[model samples]
Target: MIVKKTDNGLVMDFPALPYHKIEWSPQLQALNLKQPCVIAPYWCDRLGTPSIKARQGGRRQGELLCEIKGNRVLLYGSCHLYLKGTIYLP
Candidate 1:
């Protein structure tokens, strides 16, 4: 996995997960949260992924996109990826 900033916000790109999940989707990743997140006015959703969007208030609008609805995704700006509730790295 790698931590980098996209056009608007920071994104943690995971390599282990299936590429199709995010390939050309701009939806770098999603967090496993437990709440409802209010989306800002400035946001861009994936062409077909209405559930995904690029939120504003950062380097980019989708910066919040990493957070999705905040129900299942918790995008990270200063954190790493966690798979299966476990973060394994070299």
Candidate 2:
């Protein structure tokens, strides 16, 4: 997957693959009705670990850590940064 930030919005590029939507059953609706769910095989394969520990660049470089939780992507090492929000797909 490739992610790019443009002047208007963010762009995500991925190889073509099967996509499907799972409708909420009555039982599921009773549990939660606020959010709808869809499945993307490509996206599923791109799922990242919740926590990562590694180093980058020159010998003096510090570690580069990344975490993925729900819809948020977090990074921590010499600095801390995160991307948290909602994304719409059609």
Candidate 3:
């Protein structure tokens, strides 16, 4: 992960998959409510780990865009950013 300034705010470029909410059952919620849960074997997204471009070039990175909240993984750290997906590529 790298630290970069975004819109005048410090943001993190996490090399993690874009985890979108897949309808949680009571059992799942119980586990997730504890913060950070193991993803199921079948739970996956093909384009979730696409290439990402950082402010400076030459370094490898994954997709920056991901769901921050409401059907997305909730991220915590130096800065609290709701997992959001990247914008359309040109």
Candidate 4:
């Protein structure tokens, strides 16, 4: 996985996968949380198959939604692919 800051926000790059799941950690959740950000994935499919299994928050495409809540931030996504409840962030 590769993460880089762009003019718009942060972008994440991941190898195309047949199936994948990911979750953001506390440390990762703290990046620029106060502002609206977009985490977009690069190269997210294999022969049109989705890299991730999330239905929302763009997780199905290897992305996630980040928002500020209290002192920390929240990274939310429901990934259902290959295995249940399996998630990896970066």
lDDT of 3 by residue, 1-90 (tens): 454456844333323322375443322333344322222111223224312222211232222222234345433222233368878988
| Residues 16-44 of candidate 2: C-alpha lDDT, one tens digit per residue | 21125443232233123211112222233
Candidate 4's TM-score: 0.26
lDDT of 1 by residue, 65-86 (tens): 3344433444443333434566
Best by lDDT: 4
Q: What's model 1's lDDT at 78?
A: 37
Model 4: lDDT to the true structure:
0.36
Could you tell me the lDDT of residue 12 within candidate 3? 33
After superposing candidate 4 on the true structure, give the runs of residues whose Cα lies further than 4 Å from its correct spot: 12-61, 81-90
- Give per-residue lDDT, candidate 3, residue 30: 30
- The lDDT per prediction is 0.33, 0.35, 0.31, 0.36
Model 2 ranges off by over 4 Å? 1-48, 79-90
TM-score of 1: 0.22
Judge candidate 4 at residue 33 and give its lDDT.
39
User: Model 1, residue 81: displacement in angstroms?
Assistant: 26
RMSD in Å for candidate 2, one decimal?
A: 17.6
Considering only N, C-alpha and C atoms within 3 Å, which residue pairs clash in candidate 3? 65-84, 65-85, 65-86, 66-83, 66-84, 66-85, 67-83, 68-82, 68-83, 68-84
Give all TM-scores, in the order shown. 0.22, 0.30, 0.21, 0.26
Give the C-alpha lDDT of model 2. 0.35
Task: Determine the backbone clash count of candidate 3.
Answer: 10
